[model samples]
Structure formats: structure tokens, C-alpha cells
Target chain A: MTRVGDVLARCRAEGRAALIGYLPVGYPDVPGSIEAMTAMVEAGVDIVEVGVPYSDPLMDGPVIQYAVETALAGGTRVDDVFTATAAVRDAGAPALVMTYWNLVMRRGVETFASDLAAGGGSGLITPDLIPDEAGDWIASSESHGLDRVFLVAPSSTSERLTRATSACRGFVYAASTMGVTGTRTSVGSAAEGLVARTRAVTDVPVCVGLGVSNGEQAADVARFADGVIVGSALVRCLTEAPTRADGIRALTDLTRELAEGVRARRSTPGGAPGGASGMVASA
Target chain B: MTTPGRFGDFGGRYVPEALIPALEQLDEVRRKAMIDPEFVGELERLHRTYTGRPSILTEVPRFAEHAGGARVILKREDLNHTGSHKINNVLGQALLTKRMGKKRIIAETGAGQHGVAAATAAALLGLDCVVYMGKVDTERQALNVARMRLLGAEVVAVENGSQTLKDAVNEALRDWVANVDDTHYVLGTVTGPHPFPEMVRDFHRVIGIEARAQVLDLVGRLPDVVLACVGGGSNAMGIFHRFLDDTGVRLVGLEAGGAGVTTGRHAARFSAGERGVLHGAFTYVMQDVDGQTVESHSVSAGLDYPSVGPEHSYLLDIGRAEYRPITDVDAMEAFRLLCRTEGIIPAIESAHALAGAIDVGRELGPEAVLLVNLSGRGDKDVHTAAQWFGLLDDAALQSAGAIASADATGVSSLTDGVQV
Candidate 1:
């Protein structure tokens, strides 16, 4: 499996932000979700974050929550996440598990990390777990050689950004907005400043997530970000599709557009390929 | 401050990163307010004047007969303004909102007690208030919706997830995250992130303190057992905190057992829950083997949550408190008994505790002294009770069905001639 850091570095080398697409494992159904995510990769998603659906997705907005609820109702299990991850990776994108912390803690951090690694996962995107409280996870990720990606939000202070990026191994997930994940008309105005603040503190790539739906928004974020993450929009594509084939088609089409969007700003004079500057700032 | 976000293996800030600074800020302010005499003084004065604090402990000989002849003492939190123990937590948090210089408060409620309390606090403090109530809860507790509007709170009926307290909390949290700059999420339970469980419990600690002294003063000794219904466990923690050191006072929490634990439809978390996280804390959550939270059922909307408070989980793990499940049938019977014997229309949530007290009294016989936290009045639940007991007249039944239909269609109208 491609390491998350390698994926980000490759994106930087190519002078384009990585297109990160999210879909919950077992959404619609286990096999179908895997197929859809694999299609996303085939269409140009650089990294795929397979959400392991939880009962209560507190941080999720209506779109992701609906997908997760459907996935949970369809009996999505922890093992299915690994299967989806491996499939997405096999389809050529590094797969990361984006899940609430409870699932990892319940499965035991070390065991979860090892299982994820075995399943071809390159990293984890923990939306809720902060670095200050991630001692065990940091240890587990290091031992398993899996990237530990933590979230930094618009509400984060510079001190918090420093703390978060310090523990990050792959890239820092920058939540563009303060609310739960959803597609909004306008990306939060605070996103650019937050990315700059986070970039000033670490060499880890900074990826902005939350509210980047269409290709245009993806391109807009890609100009300032090392990666642009799209979750609710992709999930919405699957949810709104009339059938499995249609869902996969819609997902791939959107992924292709987002790919173009990311690549569109690559040669722009101000759009630099530099990731976060200091490699060992947190250490 | 020692362990800001933990109760043993449970309780931590398991929220998205966006809320971390807010939680930290809230926690810091809470720490300061905890020691600041002025904050304490304001809270105390409000409790005395507005909330009718020092709620008396009334010994019920008549109700004791139903409790197998044990001396049953009641902590009258029902007499508090807004008619429940929820006022205790809301008033305290409202004060905190002021100290934080916030001008608005947002809260979520199930049966609407907390929403009403929050609305009351907001009204008194001249702050804007918004309450998120599940569509189902707003229908069932329509009076509370009206009451909140009267108190100048915008009651937004949430139509997500299970359409209950859990969903309301989700919406409220979303709102808080989006509006964190000037708004305080007046979380209505002893759950959520770091300071919430600790802070809400502290606000309610007055219950146990007052009841302990009042019980001792009236009965000449501490009760053998303290009983309180555990929904999110604020009241149980409120009454249980002061008696934790008593050693002899067996703290018992009664959970809503809708049908029964065996039927897989109850809210008895400790009985049938697995260790999982929900609503930001690692506690005993009623979840499936795959870790998806299962919807819990209860006759009482307040107790229909799938997870317990983190502190309750810790206490249960350490064997400091015993949790028991009481079925709807038993609880309703207790509810009627409280009304018939003691002239008290107790909330069904509180009746669950009365049911437990009955069992405890039976086990220990007449010598056992029990103090039950009467958490709230049954005013909000009267419509539910009327339907449950088949007490609704023909016109009332039709309107009740209409209300149910309205709730299903996302349209609620309390002024449609359906009298309580």
C-alpha cells in the first residue's frame, strides 16, 4: 500500500494537491461501497478515507450521517473497513480509515493499527482524538508504521495547531468550517488563514476538508492546501444515486472533476508545491 | 483539574477538534467559577430566590406502605422553578455563559425539562436562547414547547436520527460548533465533553447536599439507601455525590426498562450495555456488537437514552453504586402510587426510582430508610400518561392521534384544542 506521506509528497512533487475522497465502508452495502471507492481511485482520487460507520456520528453532518446510518443499518463491521481499505488501495489510492475514536479504542489502539496495516491502510484520520491525548495511538501508529493524521479546525489556536501538527505523521486535516461535515455554498473564510497558520508550524502536509463539494471548490482549496478532501459530496453522490452502478458512476465522475480541479492550480505562479516546511518541528 | 476529562477509563473530550477550544475554555471558566466566591454567591442567591433551593425532604408514611413499610423520604426538587432538577444545572451554566461574556445559550432536551429550564434561565438572564428538541419529543411534550416559547426561546424541532434527546444533542452540538463565538451550548446532561459532566454535576450537587442535611435533620440519621432515576444521570449524580462517603448509604440508580432488558427494548445501559462512546464520553452504551448504538425505548422520554453518564459507569465499575432496571409497568404503578398515596404526580423518570426504592425496602424490610430523588413534576408527561392509562376522552384521543400524525409530518400545534 502507498504510504499517506508518500502520496502527499508525490502530490507536492507533481505540483498538485492530492484529491482525497471519503465514503463510509459498507454504505449502500459492503461490496458496493468498496466497489464505489475503488472506482473513485480509478477515476483519480489520490487517497480514499473509508469511514467505519458508528452508531452516533456526532461530528458528521446530515449527508455523511445519512450515509453512515445506512451503513450501520446494513451491518458495517470493523473488518469490513479493512476490506474496503485494501480494495481502495488495490485500486491505486492510499486508503485511510476516517473514524470516530471510540471504534479504535474499542478495538484496542495497537490491534486496530496492526489490523489496519494488514488491510493495506496507510493512515488514520481521527476527527475527534486530539494529539495531546493520543499517547497510545501515536505509539501504536509508529509500531505499525501507519500514519497518524489528526484534525486542525478553524477554531484552533496557533498553539493547538502546533500541538496537532507536532503529532501528525502524514498530513493535518484542516476542517474548513466549525460545524459538522456537509457541503456548503461557500467554504469558510477562515480556511486559508488556518492552513497558513498550520503550515507555519510543521512540515506535514495540510489538507482542508469540510464543505468542498464540487470541482470548483476543490480547486479553490487546492491552491492553498497540499490536499483537498471531499466527504459529504461524494457520500451524497452515492446516496442520491438510483442504483449501485449509478452511484459508482456518479462517484467516479465527481472524482475525475475534483482531480482536474486539484491539477488545475498546479502551475499557477503562487500555488507552490511546498508542504509544511519543518520536518521535525513537533519532535 | 487533576484529570479534566476522565472518570477512570470513561469520560474524555471525545468531540471533533472544532469543539476542543470551546471545551477547554468552558473547562477553564468552570475551574475559576468553582473557586470564585462571587460566582458561588450569585448561584446561591439565584438558587434561593428563583429556584426555591433547600427543597425540603418530606417523609412519606403513606407512600412508605407501598414501599413495603420502609421510611421513604423525598427530596423535593420538583418544587424548583420550571418543575424539575434540570433548573439546577441550567441556572449554573447560564451564569457561566454570562461570565464567558456569551449572550446566547443553546440546549437540547428530550422530554423538554432541560429545554424549559434553559429557556427559564435565558429569560431571567436576558440572554437569547435556542433549544433543539426532537420532533417526537416536541409532540409528546407539547406543553414544554409552548412554555419555552413563552420564556422567549426558539424551539427548533430536530428531525434527524432517532428524533429524540440523542438527536437533539447532535443538532445542538452542531449549532454550538457553528456559533461558538458568542453562544454557549447549555448542555443539559452529565455527558458530553470534559467540563460538562463535572460542571453539570457540580450545579446539581446542591440536591444531595441539601437532601443529606435535611434527611439527617428530619429523620435523625442518614438513610440506608439513596435512590434516583438515571437518564443522563444528572439527578442521580446530584443526590449520589453527597452520600458517596457515607459508606453505609447504598446508592442505587434505576434505569428505564421499557419492556424488560431481556426484550432488548429498554434503556437499562448498565444491564445490557457494552463499553462504547456516544455523545462524547466512553461509558456503558446500549450498542450492538458492531458498536452501532441501538435506539433505547422507555415509557418516559427522559430515560430513553442509549448511554449512561461516565461517572455512573465509573461508580458502577468500582461497585460504589448499584444500577437496577425497572420496567415501564413497575414504574407506572409506582407513579400512580405516588399520586394516590402521597398526592404527588411524579415524573415517570422519578417513578423508576420509586420502583427501585420499593424493591430495596422489601429486601431490607421496615427498618430500611430510603431517600428518593423526586426529580420532576409530571406536568409535562401528563399527555403521555393520559394516553398510556387510557384516560383520554374521545375528543382528546382523536386530537392526540392528530398530534401524533402532526409530529410524523413535522407539524406541531398545541393550540388545536387538545387540553392536558
Candidate 2:
């Protein structure tokens, strides 16, 4: 199992869903992003997903697009993604790099895998690289002892869902909505059904993302998922902040609130949250 | 996931999972429609009655004078109903949209040719149409934007990521993902993920089919070479697919060289691009060393994309076809030559092909017969052409005004010292 898998297992052992927070490296600047990620870990995020700001983020909404544009304008390089990953790992949370496939392909898949492993990164969460086109990444990550996290959506066929879940090493990402990443007033109604469908296919932990923002939404997703993944909400803290320090504080406070929401689900009896059942299935 | 759409290792669906089912449905419907006689007959009827197909092949001896005395034949795609080859694909995809029971169609366009075609098709079929155009492009091709709006389509100006065709495509994909259930993404070119490159190519294959038969009937033999501009490569691929089996015919694609390839301000993908994924297909993409897509520049908004279609990449790799860069200066010079010599105004995108023909004509010398795809008319490019030739400047306008007054008043002094 990968370090990310172990972290998810540990969170399940604690009878709570894992809180995964994402922030693009070099949002304000590289050093500032690393500090923010470190603060997230200290504030109760179980895993840190360091986003590599791409030039064309097709699956991103305006807030994340704005953050990525700022990050790219600030000169975020591929090397900085690893640096931020190391910072997150140093802060005691498992770190995963969520990136588009081209950057890794540009760096050479094996070379990128080795670099991420060297930086103590647990795995990758590829938003665009589905299992069908991930042969090279799957092999490279396995050789480097890193996880491969592919996503499943409501539109995914059962065959594709099984293939994607079976390919996943650490966990499977379930996008809660059909649209790109952004905070919605409420998560899509299809998310629970998609998560349940994914769980039926593989023993890999299923994490839900794509719209969860606040504690209520996080707790709502945590009720059915093994992990609650938040991205735009956390990145918006940095994007809308007056100062880097304030951004870090906002990130920390939000992380704690989301973390609390993930834990709060365990108090309800007969909740049948995926964390406890996923641990059993994997075991 | 399937390999049916691949051209060697180039084309595949590298898109979000939410789009996969839609692509699969589109592929299935397209495959069936291609084999269905009723569908094929309906499309043929549309082409003959609506698009004015068998778009005549014209011989231009005057223009050929500049091309080293070579015999030049023009495939008159400019005469198509929507004024370009884009109508073929949009009409076919609109039929497929109706087949899928989809109510609305969304499209992305750069030069606005495809958007206008898509809007036209949607209006003809009684479907809602929305076109995503880059903010920069909406201004550069403002005439086409107005045309689209007049065709009863809503035009959205995409504002992010260089604000060009690439960004417009990104915005269109985002819209498709959110609204895939009831809306069909009428992708503008021979790019994008699975089925699009293949389906769009199939729809446009008539260009090559008709040209090949016409050249045989007129010239009594195949031309020595065929040339077309490579933007997303639809027109080039359209006219080249039929001649692929003819080993003697040389197929060359002219890419936009805005300033020059070395200036880092051109859209010559095969000239200076690396193999990477962009807009869902693996192809020659102009990207930084870190794999970040670099902005492509071109005087012609149609060819201002940073990536080429995957099949073009495959063709280049196998040496079945050749691609070369044509600088803006060369293209404009050819654009003017076509206008002055042949009295034909070609789209700036097609002017790139005219520029390449000039060079190739010289290389092959007088006996060579060159078939050039006049992909679109330059009515939409009059503004850009006027600016390029300084015809829109105050001095030139004033000179023309003076000449007009001289004609009206029979006054020699009004015409004196006037450039006109």
C-alpha cells in the first residue's frame, strides 16, 4: 500500500473520514504556498494535494482558474510542486501531487515518479489522465512505490468505473458533479450513487470531490465517502486574502472546520460511512 | 478507452470522465450514420441543394504567372453556403445532434468561420446555438461574430488563457461537460478527443473526393501537388484524404508563420512543436519545456491555435505528407497577388497555402500542375487585409475620397498628388 493508502487506513481506524485539502503551489509565491500547505497539515488536514498550476486548466472553474493564472504568472515551475510536496510531508501529512498528465509526460513519466517519491510524495491524483491512457503512469508509479489516483464520474460507465477503481492504488477520486471544479451551493445529488457504485467495484477507498466547500458540505460527503477532498474552497482562501499571512490563517481555519466535519460523521449511529466499511473490504 | 480513433499513437480521448459517455454516444451515432443510407442520402441532398456542392474547380492562369508559370487549379470551397469548408462538418454534426435527440448545440471558433457555420446549421435545424469565441478573436473577427449573432446564435467571449482559439476550446469543453445531456458540442475542427478527428474528417472528405474527380476530368491527370493551409487541418485533411493513395501526388500543408518560426510568435506546430496532449488529443503542440502551452500568434485568427490535429502529426511522422511554415509577409503577399492577378480574394488562412504554392511552383517549375484549396473567401478578412495593406489608414481613405471628388466634379486639382 502507498503512504496515502496508509493515511486513509489510519483515518478509518480513527472512525473518521480523511480530510484532503488542496492548494496550488506558487499561488501567491512558491514559499508562501509551501507555508500554507504546512499550515494545513498543522490545522488538521490529513492529506495535502499540491496542485501543479497548468497553463490550460480545462476542468477548473473561475476561482481555481484565477488562482492558476496567478500561480503561472508568479512563475510556478514543476520543481516547485515537489518542493511543496516535501513541505507538506514534513508537516506530518501524506502529500499527493494533483497534476495534468502533460507536465509529467514532459518530465518523462518515470523521472516525474522518481522525483515525487524522492520528495516523499505519497501519490498522484490525475484529473485528466484516466486509466485507459495511464499505462505508462501506472507502471512508473508502481515501480516508484507511489499511488495512482484516477477519478470516476456519474457519467462513467460501470465498465470504466471498475477499470478506473481497479487501477487506483491509494484511493479513487469521485467527482461529485458533472462540471469542473468549483464550490457549489450543494453537491450534486448523483455523488452518493456514484460513490456507492464505485465502492461496489473495488476495495480502494473512494473520496468525493468537485464541489464540497464548507463544514456542512464536507460532513455531507463524509457521510458516504471514505475521504472528503476540497480544492477550490481552500485555494480561494489564498486567492481572496489581503495578505499571505491572512491566507495561511484562512486556510488553517477552513482546514480545521472541514476536518471537524469529516470527524463529526462518526458520532451518528448506523451511519454506514464508507470509511469503516472500506477498511473492512480492503482487509 | 477504445483505440478506434487513434492514428498510430497520436489520437485518443484524453478528456474528463464526464465527457466520456457523450463521446461514446457521439461515436456510436456517427458510425451508424456513416453506414445508414437514409442518413447518407439526406446529407447528400443537403450538400447538393443547400451547400452547392460540386463547388467548382477553377483554373487561374493569371495567378499561376507568379507561381513560376505553373498551372494552378483552385478547389472553390469558398463558394460553399457558409463561405468555407466548415459548413460540411457543422451540418453533419448538427444532423448527428438531431439523431442523438439533443436540443441545443455549442461550438468553439477562432476565425468565426466555424461559429458562423455552426450557427447557420443550428438555425436551419431549429436548435439553440451558442458559440464560444476568444475575446481577442471576437474583436479580430468581429464581422463573423455579428454574422453568427444574426444567424440566431449567442456569442460568448472567452476571456481566459491567452483569449484565443485554445481558450475558446477550453471554455466550450467546460460548457459541454456541464450540459452534455441536452446539448451537443459541435467541435469546430479536426482536433479534440475521440471520434471528433475521425468524424469531422469523414464529413470533409468530400472536398478531396470532388477535387480529385474534377482535376481528372479537367487536367486529364492528377496534379503534381496539392496544397492547403493547416489550422486545425480540416480543409487540408478534407482535400488530402482522397489523394492519400495516389503515390505520385505530393500533399503539403502550409502552417501559419506569424512572423517566422524562430520568432516564438508563430503557429507552426510541426515546425517547432513537441508531441503532447492539448484539447484532448495527443499531437504536435507548441508548449514550453515544462509542458505549459505557449500562446500562438498569427495574422489570420483561424490558424492561431498552438496545436495541430493528431492525424496531421501521424502523417508527418510517416512522411506521407509534408508541412512547412509560411510567414505572415509571404502569406499577405500571396493574398494580394491572388486579388490583383486572379481578381479572387482568398481567406488569409488559405493565403498561407497560396504562399506555399508559390515556393513549390518555383521548385517544380512551369510544367507542374498545383491544386490549391481556396478554403474560404476573404469577405471576412477585408478588415485585416485593409489594415495590412494600409488601405484603411486615413491617408489612403483621404486619397480615395479625393479621387471620388475628382470624378464627381471633373476637377484635376482634387486628384493631384493623391496616392490613389
Identify the leading candidate in terms of DockQ.
2
Query: What are the Cα lDDT values of the candidates?
Result: 0.87, 0.90
DockQ for each model: 0.56, 0.61
Q: Model 2, residue B404: what's the lDDT?
A: 27
> Model 2: what TM-score?
0.95
Candidate 2 lDDT tens digits, B1-420: 345689988989888878888999999999999999999999999999999997999899989889999999999999999899999999999999999999999999999899999999999999999999888887677667767766778888888989999999999999998999999999988999989999999999999999999999999999999999999999999999999999999999999999999899999999999999999998999999999999999999999999999999999999999999999999999999999998999999999999999999999989999999999999888767887898777886554444223321122332241222
How far off is residue B337 in model 1, in Å? 0.6
Which lDDT tens digits does candidate 1 get at residues A70-187? Answer: 8877777888999888888788888988988878877878889999999999989998787766888898888888888899988898888898889888889999988888999989
Q: Over the stretch A172-231, how does candidate 2's per-residue lDDT look in tens digits?
A: 999998999999999988999998888788888999999999999988888888899999
Report the number of the highest-lDDT candidate: 2
The superposed Cα distance between candidate 2 and the true structure at residue B49, in angstroms, equals 0.8
Model 1 per-residue lDDT tens digits across residues B1-420: 123678898888777778888888999998999899999999999999999988888888998997789999999999999999999999899999999999999999998899999999999999999999988887787777777876778889888778898888888988988899999999988998888898999999999999999988888999999999999999999999999999999999999999999999999999999997888887888876556678999999899999989999999999999999999999999998888898999998999999998899989889889999999999877777888888979897776556444442222454552443
